[model samples]
Target chain A: MSESLQVNTMADLMAQGKKPEVLFWVGCAGSFDDRAKKITRAFVKILNNVGVNFAILGTEESCTGDPAKRAGNEFLFQMQAMSNIQVLNGYEVKKIVTTCPHCFNTLKNEYPGLGGNYEVMHHSQFLQKLMEEGKLKIEGGEFKGKKISFHDPCYLGRANGEYEAPRNLLQELDAELVELKRCKTQGLCCGAGGAQMFKEAEPGKKEINIERMEDVEEAKPDIVAVGCPFCMTMMTDGVKTKEKEDSIKVYDLAELIAESNKL
Target chain B: MGISNIFFIIALAAAGFWFAKNLNKIIRNINLGKDIDRGDSKAERWKKMFMVAIGQSKMVKKPISGALHIAVYVGFVIINIEMLEIVIDGIFGTHRVLAEPLGSFYNILIGSFEILAFLVLISCLIFLIRRNVLKVKRFGFREMLGWPKTDANIILIVEIMLMSAFLKMNAADYVLQQRGVEHYIQAGAFPISGSLIVPLYESFSTGFLIFVERVSWWFHIIGVLLFLNYLPYSKHFHIILAFPNVFFSKLDPKGKFTNMEAVTKEVKLMFDPEADPYAAPAEPEGPVERFGAKDVQDLTWKQLMDAYSCTECGRCTEQCPAAQTGKLLSPRKIMMDTRDRLEEVGKNIAKHGADHSDGKSLLGDYILEEELWACTTCNACTEACPVMIDPLSIIMDMRRSLIMEDSKAPAEITNMLNNIENNGAPWQFSQTDRANWVNEG
Candidate 1:
C-alpha cells in the first residue's frame, strides 16, 4: 500500500496553479480490483520516484466505456466517452498515461474520433522513455537472473503493434527474458478482451485463458509479466487453474520494476 | 455472312444475357443493405483502390502466396485482351481483326497473351497444390470444408482449363498457318505455345488442325463467359467486387470504431446545460431502429459489399486470437455467414415480393452469439484481410443488436454495466474510493 504518497488530482493541481506533464487514467480495474490496485501503486511509486509530475482524474475518472463499447452498447459507450471527453477538455488535457491497455487503447485510438484527442502512452512506454532519459535508475537485485515471460495484452500488442516498449523495460530488470511460442503479433489473448473480462465465457471446449495459460506453462518462466489490468485478472485466474499460483507468479511490468528497485 | 457467324453471334448474345441477369441479382442483393455515406474522400478512396485492389499491396504481405496470387490476377486481366479480339471476330465474321491493321503490334500482343496464359496455368496449378496438396492450415479450417474448398478448387481448375484451351487454339492455328491454308492467315504470334505444341499438331491433317483450332477457340470464349456468370455464386466474386470494396473501405485510423450519431446527439443534450427544454423534440426517423445489425438488411451497403468481396483465404481467421485459442469465433465464418444470409434474403425477395419477411436473420440462425462474444475486437481480422473485408464490423454490429436491442448480455457483463452506471466505473467501488490506492503505501 502506498500510504505515505500524496497523490494529486487534476482538480487539485489546477487549483494550485500547477499542471502535470501527463494525466494518469487509473482505469476501473486498476482503481478497484484488489490485485490490480497493486499494479497502480507500483506504477505510481515509479512516477513519484522518478520525479515525473503526473496527476490522476481521481474521483472524476470513469470507465472509458471500452467494455460497454465492445459489448455493443453504443449508447452507454457514447455516454461514458462524452463525459470523460468533457472533463479532459475542461482541463485541456494534452497527454495521458494509463496502466490498463484497454483505457490506453480507447483513449489513444477511440477518443480522437469522438473529439477527445490526447497523446496517450501506456505506462510501460512512459517508463521506457524515463529510463532512456536516465531519470529512473533500476536495480535488478533479486530479479536479475529470474526468468520472465511477458504476456502481451491484445490491445497493446496486436491492436496497437507495441511489442517492444514493455520488453525493453523488462530488459532493464536484467531478467532472463523468455519468449512464448505465440508472442508479439502471434500472441494469444488472455481471453478478457472485447469486454470478455466482464462476462462469463460462453460455451466452448475449454476456456481461452486456460488455453493461453498453456503457452505460459510452455515458456516455463518464473514470472508471467502482464501490462493490462484485465490481463492481470485473467492470467492470475489462469495460474490458479493450473494450481501453480504458489510456484509461479503473475506480475505487471511496473510491479516487477518496483520490486526489483525495492520500492 | 456465313452460317457459323450467325451461330457465334447467338451464343455471344446468350452468354451476355446470362451474365447481365446474374450481375443484376448481385446488385439487388447488395442494395438490400441500408445506405451509408461512403462517398467522402474521393481522392483517398481512389488511391486505396489502386493500391490495395489494383496493386495487390496487401496481398503481398505474405510473399509466397502473394506472388502466386498476383501472377493469377495479372494473367486474368491481361488475357482479356484476346477476349476482346474474339468478341469482335465472333460477331463480325472476321478472324484476327486487329492483326491486319496492327501487323507486328498485333503479333506482340498475341505473344504477350500466350506468355500470360502459360503463367495463369502455372499459377493456378501451384494454387491448387497449395490448397489441396500442401494443405495450408488456413485453407483447411473447419468452415472451409464444403463449398469453400470446392469453390477454390473449381475456380483454379476452370482457370487451368481456360488457359489450356487458349494455348491449344494457338497451337492448332499455328499449324494451319504452317500449311499455308486459305482463310487461316498468319497474323498473330504464339511465341511459347506455338513452339511447344508444334510437334503434336504436325502429324494432323489440315482439316483436323482447323477443326481443333475452331473447337478450342469456341471453348475458350464460352469458358470465359461461364466464368463471368459463375462469379456471383462463388467467393471468386472478389475479381469484380474487390476493386469497389477496397475503394469504399473504412479509411479512418484502423482502431477507431464508429460512434453512433443518435447516441452522440443524446450525449450532447446531456452535456449542454443551456439546451432548450421547451424545444420540439427531435423528430423520430420513421420507426425506432435497433442500434446494431441483427439481419443482413441492418448492415451498411459497404459491409454487404465486403461480404460479397471476401476471398475466404482465411487469413483473418488464421490471425484471430480467439480461433487460435480454441474459441468458436472465426472471422472468416462471420463473412461467409453474412454472405450466405444475404443470399438467402435475396432469394426470398426474388421468390416473394420486396416487402416479404422470412423471419430468419443473419444473427442466431447463421451466426451464433457465442462466436460474437469470443472476438477480442483486436482488429486482427481487418488487418489480415487481403481485400479489406471487415468481419469485426459485422461482429460489433451484431453485438450492438444483442446488447442495445435485446438487453441480452451475459449476466456478468450486465453486472459490470450496472457497476459502470452506478459507480462510474466497471467495479463495485464508489467514485470517492477510486484513489484509495494512493494511501496504501
Candidate 2:
C-alpha cells in the first residue's frame, strides 16, 4: 500500500536487488477491465523510460473501498479497506503512486482507519514532480490527433484536491489542450462516483455521465482524457452511447504521457 | 347532541384528532433519511429539525413571506400553550388562572397572541396577493411550472380558520369577563368564554350568550390541534422535519458529492491478484444484484421517510433547472414517487423480500430513464432538502448498480462505457490529442 502511495520504500523490500524507489499502484482502470488500460500503461512506461525505475504491482491491487463507503454501507467499506491494507502490507511495500484518482484519494484518505496507512501520490503528482526535477525527460515527439481537452474526475479534483498535477503532466507531454467551461474544482461528477458507477439511477431523464460527456462533445474536442476509472468508463460509454465513438477518444493521463514518450 | 353537548363533543373530537395527527408526524419523520435512521443522537438530529423543519430556513427567499411565516410559526407554538390556560378555564369554570404570577399576567400574554395572529393574518394576505393576485416572481435560480399556489393557499386557509376561531373564542371571553362568570367551565371554556359573552355579550340574554360562547370554544382549541395532527399526512410535515435538517445541515455544504469505491473488493485486498470488479462486486457468488431501486422499499429507509417529511414547499422543484427548463423532472415528484413506490414495495416486502424481489431488476422502468440521468448531481436537491435527506446519493447509487452490474444504462451511457473500456477517456479522437487541453499554445 505504501508503495502505491509512494510513502516509503520499506526496509523489508530493500534487500531485493533493483527495487524501484517508488511503487506505482496502477489501479483497475490502469490495469485490466478498463478501456483506458493502454493510456495507463503509457504512464507507467514513461516512468520506466525516464529511469524512474518504478515497480508496478498488479493482482495485489484491491478496490479502494471508496465505493462501498459512499453507498452508505460502512461495514463493507471497512472490510474492503482492511482487505486492501493487508494486501499492501503483505508485500512490505512502501511509497505508492497511482494513475486512478479514485484509488489515489481512497488510499490517501480511507486507508488510515484500517491501519494500512502510507503517503500516497497520484501518478500526476509523481510524474509531474519527476518532470519538474528533470528526472523524466520529454523529447517532444511529433504530436498528431485532434484538439484535446481534459476532464477532471471529481474524486481527483474535488475529493483529494488534485486539479493541477494531471494538467501539469499533460503539459510536460507537450499536448495542446482546451479547457472545458466546467473543469478543475467546479468539475461535475461523471455520474460515476458516490457509487453511482455501480447502480442504476432512479429513472428520470438522462444518464449523468452522458450529460457530462455531451458537454465535452460540445467542446468539439476529439479526446477527453480523465483521471478516474469511473470517469473514463462513464465518459467512454457516454461517447459510444451518444454515437460519437468514431470521432472522440479517451485515455488515462499516464497513457497519454507514455504515448508522448519515444514509444 | 344538545347545543352545549354538541359543542362539547366537537371539542373532544377535535382534541382527539389533533393528538392523532402529531403522533402520526412523529412516526412518519422517524423514517426520512439514511443518517437519521443511523441512530444519530437526538441532539445531532434535533439541530436539523430546529433549523430546517421547524425553522423553514429554506423558505426564506422571500423576506416578506418568510418573516411573516416565521412569526406565525412562533405564535402558533407559544400561543398554543397559553391557549391551554383558556381550555383549562373552560373545564374548571374559572375565567382567570391569574390568582398567581402566570394567571396574573395571563390576559396580557393572551392579548399579544391574539394580536399576533392578526399580524400573521395580514402578512399571509400579502403573500397570497403576491402569488395569486400580483403573482410574486418565483424564487431561486430557476422558474418552476404548474407550481401549486395551493400549498400557500392551504396554509393560509388553516391559519385564517384557526385565527378566526380564536377570535370568536375571544369574543366569548370578553363577554364572560363583563358578566363576571368566575366559575363557568363547560368545554372547560366558559370562564374564558364567560369573558367572551360579557360586555359585548350583554346584548344577548344569558342563555343565548352561553350557547354562542360554547360554539367558539369548539373551534379554537380543536382547530389548532387538528392542524397539528394533519401535518404528517400533508406537505406540512416539513414543519417538523425542517427543524432537524437545518440544524444538522451537512458540515461540508460545499462538498457536492461523495466518491464510490474504486473496485469490488469484499476483502481487504488492495493487492489481491484479481481485484477488479468494475461496478457492483461480482455479487458474492449470487447475492442480491441490485441494478437500481426496484421499489420504494429498496430505497434507504430515510428516503422512504422523506415523503412524510416533505413540506411540499416547492423549494426543490423551484431550484431545479430541469424542472424549470421543461424536463419531466420534478424534485417534488421524485419525493412523492419514492414514497408511493415505497408504499407499493413495502406492502410486498412486508409479505416477504424474497417473494417480492423475484425476476425484477430494481432499475426496471419504475423510475424513468430521463429523470435518473438528467440530474446534474448538483446537490440542488440536497441543498434544497430541508430535512437533509440525501436523495442525489440514492439516485446515483441506483444508476451505478444498473450500469455497472446489470449493464443497463441509457444508450448514451452504454456507448460511453464501451468507449471507456476501449479508450482511457470518453472522446474517440486519436489517443494522441488527449493532453491538448492543458498545453494550448
* lDDT tens digits by residue: candidate 1, A89-129: 99999999999988988898888877999999999899999
The DockQ figures for the candidates are 0.56, 0.06
lDDT of 1 by residue, B97-143 (tens): 88888989999899998998898899999999998899999898889
After superposing candidate 1, which stretches have Cα over 4 Å from the reference? A1-3, A112-115, A131-150, A167-183, A213-225, A239-250, A256-263, B99-109, B129-137, B140-142, B187-196, B274-281
CA shift of B386, model 1, Å: 0.8
Q: In candidate 2 chain B, what residue range of length 10 has the lowest lDDT sum? A: B139-148
**lDDT (tens digit, per residue) of candidate 2 on A38-149:** 5555664566467665555443444555544444444345555676677677666578888777677778776765576787888778878888898876654444544678
Reference contacts preserved by each model: 0.70, 0.03
Flag regions of model 2 displaced more than 4 Å.
A1-263, B1-37, B40-62, B90-101, B134-152, B175-212, B244-292, B343-366, B404-406, B418-441
* Alpha-carbon shift of residue B418 in model 1 (angstroms): 1.1
- In order, candidate lDDTs are 0.88, 0.59
**TM-score for every candidate vs. truth?**
0.90, 0.58
Q: Give the number of the best model, judged by DockQ.
A: 1
